[model samples]
Target: MPSEQDLRTKIESGLPDLHNLIVTDISNGCGQSFDVVVISNTFEGKNKLQRSRQINNLLKQEIAQIHAFSCKCYTEAEWSKVVV
Candidate 1:
């Protein structure tokens, strides 16, 4: 099982110009499930489904091992609103 930090590292390495990346281990200490929030300009002009597919593709290896992997992808502009 990958640690939360390891998962975060993989996500950052796989995505270019990634910003405000946050990954949470939500498996109640099992370390097998994760919730991820990613903010990046790379998501610009992409719809929600497209953004999700891109992230799913980027983290294919990690996704395979985890029991659950939920990701929320946002463009910089969208993230600003979500935070506030």
Candidate 2:
């Protein structure tokens, strides 16, 4: 039953070096689904699937609270391209 603020706070605290983190609740007020986009240097050398696995592992507990998750994980270089 955590609020979006609580979720964001937890993610931020857990990922200190993450550059961009976005979490959206998509469960029609049920808090059971979320869409997340995270950009981090930690993902620099990883493939897409590996990056996703890393995020899944970090948010294992939170993931249990969500029934569905749409995630986009990106490295710093990829993020820079999008920002430009």
Cα lDDT of all candidates, in order?
0.87, 0.80
Single out the weakest 10-residue window by summed lDDT for candidate 1: 2-11
TM-score for all models, in order of appearance: 0.91, 0.81
Best lDDT among the predictions, by candidate number: 1
Which regions of candidate 2 deviate over 4 angstroms? none
Q: Model 2 compared with the native: what TM-score?
A: 0.81
Residue-level lDDT of model 1, residues 1-84, one tens digit each, is 777888788778888888789889999878899999999999999898999999888778878888998999998889999889
In model 1, where do residues sit more than 4 Å from their true spots? Answer: none
lDDT of 2 by residue, 8-84 (tens): 78778876578888888888778888888898888877899998887787778878877787789888889878889
User: Using TM-score as the measure, which candidate wins?
Assistant: 1
Error of 1 at 67 (Å): 1.0
How far residue 55's Cα lies from its native spot in candidate 1, in Å, is 1.2
Clashing pairs in 2: none
